[model samples]
Target: MKTYLAHGTRFEDTALCRFLNDYGHADLDALHASAREEPTRFWAEVEDAVGLTWHRRYHTVCDLSHGPEWPRWFVGGELDLFENLVGRRARATPEQPALIWEGDDGDLRRFSWRELDDAARRLTTALARLGVCPGERIAMYLPMVPETAVVFLAAARLGAIVLPLFSGYGADAVASRLIDSEAMVMVCADGYLRRGKRVDMLGEARSAAAAAPALAHLLVVPRLGTPWAPQASGQWREWDYRSLVAACDPDTGPTIHGTATPLMILYTSGTTGRPKGVVHTHAGFPLKAAQDLLMAFDLNPGDRLAWITDMGWMMGPWLVFGGLLRGATLVFFEGTPDHPTPDRIWQLVGRHRLTHLGLSPTLARLLMAAGDAGLPQPGQLDSLRVFGSTGEPWNDAPWHWLFESVGQGRCPIINYSGGTEIGGGILGCFPGLAQKPCGFAGPIPGMQADVVDAEGTSLLDQDGDEVGELVLRAPWPGMAHGFWRDAARYLDTYWSRFPGLWVHGDWARVDADGHWFIQGRSDDTLKIAGKRVGPAEYESALVAHPLVAEAVAIGVPHPVKGEVATCFVTLADPAAADSADWHAHETALIAHVAGLLGKPLAPARVHRVSALPRTRNGKILRRLVRAVWLGADPGDLGSLENPSALDALRDYRDSLEAVV
Candidate 1:
C-alpha cells in the first residue's frame, strides 16, 4: 500500500479503506452492493468522496425505470459542469493560473481563472453569433494552445457538441469527421509548429471545409498569418480570433446551460470505415473525470499536472476537467515531449516541482533509449509524486525502469487502461492497493470490473486472478451513452459480448494477490495455427532484449500456419541500424522469442525498422503496420504525428518482397 501517488501522507485509514474492509466482499462486489442495495447512499457516498458541489441537491440517486440498458444519470438534477470548472474557481480564486500554455517557439501564455472565464465567454458569444445552437456540432482542429482548450469549454458551455480533430490530420481525414458531425463551423489555426517546422492547418482545414458543405464559418486563428487566406470566406483579409473575441460581449444571452446536454463527440477506431463518434454528456464527463482525478491519483489544489496530448484524444478532456475541477495548475506544452532536448520532460518535472507527472510507456522507452547519458541528476525527478500510464499496455522492463530509474524507485506507476467511450478508466489503480510491476491495481472507485472466460463465466474465486475479457457487470458514471450516430453498433460492439454486461475489448487478468494485468486489445487478437494470442505477449518479449528500444507485433497472412506472428522493432541506437548488426540483434531477439513462446507460434520474422508510426499520443498503430504488410489500405495516416515512418515501413515491406 506504500505510494507516492498520494501527497506523501499515508491514507490507509481513510473512508476509502473503511469501505474496502467493511463490506467483506471484493471491490467490484462491494461497489455493486453499494450501488444496488443502498442506491441513494451509494451516489451520495460517491458525491462526497468526489467533492461534488450541490448547487441544488438531488431527490434520487439511482433511478433506472428502463433498466440498466437505458439508465438515466442524475434524473431531476440541475448541475452545470461549467460552473464546476470555470465559474466556481473564478469566483473564489480569480488570479490562480487555470492554464499554463507554452508554444513550440518557446512563447509562454498563462491564463488566470478570471481570464479563462472572460475568454471562454467571448468565444462562446462569437459561436452564438455564428448561429451555433444548443446540441449543434462545432469541429475543432487545433493544437495544445490556450485557444484550443477555450474553444472546447466554450462549445461545452453553450451546450454545443465539440468535435476535436488532431491538428496534424490532413484534409481528407479532417473532412470525414466534419461531415460526420455535420459541423456548421470549424475552429482552426493558420499554422502550427511540429518538430520546429510550420504546418499550414488553416489552409488544409479550409480545403477540408469545402468538402464539408455543412461548414458555414471557418474561425481561423492566424498564429503565423503569413500568406494564408480562407478558401471560401474572402470577406476578411486576415482572421484574428482575438478581434472576434474583442467585438463580442462577455455576457452572451444568459448561457444556454444544462447538465445532460450533449458536450462532445470523440471518435474511436472502428473495425472498418471512419472511427465511430462516441457522445458524452456534460454532467457525467467533467464530474466523473474529476472524481477519477481525485480518487486515482489523489490530485490536490497545488499539484501541477501535465501529460503530452492533443485535444483530439480523450486525455485532452480528461486532463482539462481533472486538473481544473480540483484546483490543480495544468502545464500545457504545445510541443513535443522530446522537443529541444530529450531531457525537456525531466527539466519540466524539476522546474515546475511537478507533483503528478503523467507519461506513456512509449515515451519512457524513447527517453530511456535516448540514453540517460543525456539525462539530469537523479534528484531532478524528486518533485515527481506519481507517474501515470495510459493508451497502451506497459512492458515490465519499462515499468520497472520507470519505477526505479525515472522515479528513482520512489514513485508508483499507475497503469490506467480505458477507452474513449468510457471517458475515464473502467479499470485503474487507487495506489492504496498492492501493485505488481506492469500490472493495474484494480478497477476505479465506482467501476465494477471482472475478468471472465470466453463463455462469460467467472474465472476466479474470491481474490481470483486469471486471464479473461475485462468486463463491467454494473454501470459507472464514466461510461458513454453510445456511439454518436451508431447506437446499435455500440450495443453490438460492447454489450453483445455478454448479457447486460459491458465487455471492454481487452484481454485482462488478475493474479491470486489481486494484481491486474492488461494483455492487449481483444480486437487485435492473433491466431497462430488456431491458437489465440495477444500481440502484447510477443512485443513484450521482444522489448525485453537489451538492444530493442520498441517493438510491435502483428498477425501476418501465412500460407501454412494461416497467420504467423510478425514483429517490427526499433533498436536502442541508430548505430545498430546496419542490417548486419540489426540482423544479429534480431537473431538473438528471435531466439529469445522462440524460447519464450515455443515453435509453431514463435515469430515468423523479426524485422528492424527505423521507427514505428504512432499517434500524437504515442500509441503504436499496429493495425496500420499489418495493413501495409498485407498491401491493404492503412485507413487514416493523418492522425499520425510521424507520417514518414509509414514510408520507411513501406520501404522495409518492399525489401521483404525483394527476396520473395
Candidate 2:
C-alpha cells in the first residue's frame, strides 16, 4: 500500500497534539490507550476541551451498570444542545458566519451566529404557539437550505424531538417515517431546483401529511418563491414558514432538558422491513461529532466546513451540530455536486474557501471520471487543509485522485467509517498520522474497537492475512440509546451476535503497519469455493479498469460454489455502451478482473448499465441490486436516490430470461 504524509505543518502544530499535551499524553496511541482505560475521565476532559456548557452539572460522567448496550452518559446533567451550539456561540461571536447556503442557480444566503440564533428562537416560539411540546416529534422533510438548519435549531430549542426525512423522498416514503415516529408537525418546502428542474415537494408533503394521521401542521418554505395557499384538508393545517416566524416573538428562551433526554430520532433503512429509528440524546451525538472534528479532523473556529449531503442524512445534522459547536462556518449546498457543470463542486470549494470538505467515495468516483479539464485550476482548492470521506469504503483510484490531484498532496484524507447508530465515527485518520490510501489510522479514541473472529477471538493476534467482524468492547458517548420504542430489536440487531460486544457488521483488517481497512458490510460478504471475500474486492478490481466508472459486486446463488460474484457496472463514457463491440468490451473487462484477482475470485459475469442504485448520500445499495437481479422483492427502497436504475436492471434480467 502507498502512504501519504501531510506536508503542510508539523505534528506539534495540530489540535490533536495540543489535546495530547493538555492531557499529559505523549502521542496519539498513548491517548487512545488512556481513553480506553479511563473512559469517564477522558470524556470529562473532552467535555471541557469542547466547551460544552451545562445548565446543571452531572453527578456522574457515565453509568454503565446496565451494561455497555444501554449505558447512560452525563447522568443528572441539564443542557439544551441548541444553547451550546447556537445561543452561546451567538453571545460570544455575534458577527461570525454560522451558516452559508448556495442554491443550484447560484443564489447565496449567509447568516451570522446571532442571526441564526434569533431565527431559531422565533421559530421555536411559533412551534410552541402551535401547541408543540417537549418529547413531541417534529419532522423536517425539506431540502438543504438555511431554513433546514433553522428547523433543527428551533426543534432543539423547543425541546421537540427532530425527525429528518430525505428531501428526495416520495409521498409514500415520507409517510412511512412520519407514521413510525408519529410526528405532530412536519416542515417542508414548496419546491426546489435539481439539475435545472423543479421538484414538487409540496404535492408530496400534502400527500404524506394526509397519509400520516398524527401530523397536524405542515410548515412550508417558499424555496422557489411560488405563491401558495393551504389546501382544504381536515387532516392537517398548513402555514407559510416565513409568515409564521414573523408573527412570533424571538424572546422565548431555550427549554432545558436532562443529558440523556431524546433530541432526535433518525431512521435508517433495513434490508427486509420498516426503517429503524436510531435514537440520539442531547449530549451524545453533538459531543462525539465535536470531538471527532476537533481532535481528528483538526477543525478550528472560523474555518469553513462543507459536506455535500442532504438534510436527512446523518452527516447533515453532524455538520450542523459539530461545526457550530466547534465555532466553524458551515457551507450547505441546495443541489447536487455536478449540476449544470462537472466543476460545480470544485467551484463551490473555491467560492466558499472551505477548509474542510467531506464527500463519499461514489461521488469522488463520479468526479474522477470528469477528468482534469472538469476540475479546478491551480490555487482553486488551495484553501482546503483536510479532506473527509465516509458513507462507503473507497477504491484506490478515486482515493488517490482525491488525495494527490485535488488536495495537491498537502492535505490528509481522513477516511472516517461509522454508521448512523454509532453517532459519528468508529475509525478515522488523525492529522499527525501518516495515512495509506483508503485506510484509517485506527479506531477513534475511546471507541475500544477490535477485529474479532466468529468466536469473538482477536484477529490481530493471529498470523498471515485475516479479516473479521469489527466489534466494540466498551461503550462510548455516541452509541445510540436504543431504537425508538423497540428496545428488543436494537439489542437483537447489534448485541445479540456477540455476548458483550457491539458487533458492527463490517469486515475489517489491520495491516502490518497497524492501519485499519474496512472491506465491506459483513452481511454483504461472499463465500466462494470455501473462501470468504468482500464485495468491495471485486468492485474495486472492476473499477480499476479504464472503462468502468462505478461498479457493484453481489453474490448470486450457485450450485457448485454455493455462491458466485456477479458484477454490475456503469461506463465512464455513455457512448461506449452504444458501440457495436460492446460484448467484446464486457469480455475484456471480465478478463481484466480475472487477471487482477486470481481466476477463482473473478466475477462470473459483468453487466453494463447507465447508473447504479444509490442512496441520497451516494452509497450503492448492493442488496437492492442483488434482489433486483434475482427477481426477489426489494424491501424498503425509501432511501434509494434513483429508482429508475432498478428498472434498468430488471429490463436486463428480463432480456436474459427471454434468451434462456
Candidate 3:
C-alpha cells in the first residue's frame, strides 16, 4: 500500500503533539490505549482541555448504571451550550470574528463575538415572548445564513431544543419532523438565492406549519428582501423575525440546565422506517465536537473553518457548536458549491483565507472530474493548512487528486468516519500521524473501537487481509443517549447484533502498518457465490477505468450465484454517453473490474447514467439504486437531494424490461 509520511516538523507543534507531551505520552497510540482503559479519567481531561464552562460541577464524568447502551455523561453538572459557545467567547474576545456569511449573489456579512451574542440575546427574548419554554422544540428550516446561527444560539440560550431541518426539504418532509417532534415553533426564510435564482422557502414553511397541528408560530427571515405578511390562522401565527427581535429587550442571561439536557434532536432518516431523532445534550454533542476539532483536526482559536453543508446536516451543527467553542471563526455559504462558477469553492477558500476546510468525497469527485481548469490556480489555496473529509468512502483517484493537486501534498487529509448517532468520529486521521490514501489512523480517543467477525471476535489480530464489522466495546460520551421516544428501535438497531457490543454497521479492515480503512456500509455489503465483497471494492475498480467518473455497485439476486454485482456509473466526459462506442466503453469497464478482482467476482452488468440518488450531504443511496432497479419501494427519501435522478434510473429500468 502507498503511504504518505507525515513531516516531522508538522507534528512538532500540533495540538495532538502538545497533548502527548503534556501527558508524558510518547505517541498517540499510547494515549489511545490509556483512554480506552480508563475512559472516565480521559474524558475529564478532555473536558478540561476543551475548556467547557460549567455552572455546577459534576460528581462523575461518566455514569453507566443504565448500561453502555444508555450511558449518562457529566452527571450532576449544570451548564448551557449557548453560554460556552457564545457568551463566554464574547466576553473574552469581543472583537474577534465569530461568524462570517456569504450569499450566492456575492453578498457578505461578518459578526464579531460580541455582535453574535447580542443578536442571540435579542432573539432569545423574542422566543420567550412567543411562549417558547425550556424543553420545547424549535424547528429551524432556514437556509445557511446569519439568521440560522442566531436562531440556534437563541433557542439554546432559552434551554429550548433545536431541530435543524434541511433547507432543501419539501413541505411534507418538513411537516413530518415538525409533527414527530411536536415542535411548538418553526423558523424559516422568506427565500434564499441558489445558482443565482431565488428559492421561495416561506411557502413550504407555511404549508408545513399548517399540517403540523402542534405548531403555534412561524418565524420568517426576510432573506430575499421581498415584501411579505403573516397569514395567521387559528392558534398558529406568523411573525417577521427581525420585527420580533426588535420588539423585545435582550435576554442577557442564559438558562442553565443539567449537563445531560437535550440540546438538539437531530433526525436521521433510515432506509425503510420513520426518521430516527438522535438526541444530543449540551455537554454531549458539543463537547465531543470540540474535542474532535481540538485533538483530531487541531483546530485553534482565531482560525477560520468552513465546511460545505446545510444547516440540517450534522456537520452544520458540528461546525457551529465545535468551531465556536474552540473560538474559531465560521464561514457559511448560502448556496451550492459549484454555483455561479465551477471554482466558487476555491474562491471562497482563497477569499476567506480559511485554515481548515471540510468536504465530502463525492464533492471532491465532482470537483476533480472538472479537471485542471476547474481546480484552484497557483497560490489560490496557499492559506489552507489541512483538508477534512467525511460523508462517504473515498476512491483512490479523487483522494489522490485532492491530496496532490489541491493540497499540493503539504497538508494531511483528516479522513473522519462516524454516523449521526455517534455524535462525532469513531475513527479519524490525526495531523500528527502518517497517512495512507483513503485510510484512517484509528479510533478517536475514548472510543473503544475494534473490527469483529460474525461471532464478535476481534479481527485486528488476525490476517491483515480480513475485513469485518466495526464495533465499539465501550460507550463514549458522544454516543446518542437513545433515539427520541424509540428505545426499542435504538437498542435493536445498534445493540441487538452483539451482546454488550455496539455494532456500527460498517465493514472495516486494518493493514499491516495498523492503518484502518472503511470499505462501506456493512448492510450494503454484497455476497457473491458465498464470497462477501464490499461494494466499494467493485466501485473503486470501476472508477479506476479512465472513462468512469463515479460508480455505485449493488447486489442483484441471481438463482445461480445467489447474488451478483450490478453497476451504475456516470462518465467523466458526459458527452461520451451519445458516442457510438458507448457499448465498447461499458465492455472495457467490466473487463477492468474482472482484471482487478477475479472473473467469478466480476460485475454482471454495467449501465451508464447521468446521476445517482444522493442525500443532501452527498451519500449515494445504493439501496435506493437497487430498489429502483428492482421496482421495489425506495423508502424514506425525505433526505434525497435529487429526486429526478431516481426518475432517470427508473426510466432505464423500464427500458431494460421492454428490451427483455
Q: List, residue by residue over 473-507, the lDDT tens digit for candidate 1.
A: 77665678788888888788889868988898888
Model 3, 144-235: lDDT tens digits are 99988898888888889999998988998899899989999998999899888999999999888889999999988999999987895896
lDDT of 2 by residue, 536-620 (tens): 8888898899889999999999987789989999998888666577889888988898898878887888988888999977889
TM-score of each: 0.92, 0.98, 0.98
Which of candidates 1 and 2 reaches a greater TM-score? 2
| Candidate 1 lowest-lDDT run of ten | 1-10
**Candidate 2 lDDT:** 0.89
> Over 4 Å off in model 3, which ranges?
6-9, 577-580
Q: Model 1: residues >4 Å from true position, as ranges?
A: 1-9, 13-40, 54-56, 225-239, 252-256, 462-465, 528-531, 581-584, 598-601
Which of the predicted structures, 1 or 3, would earn the higher lDDT when compared with the native?
A: 3
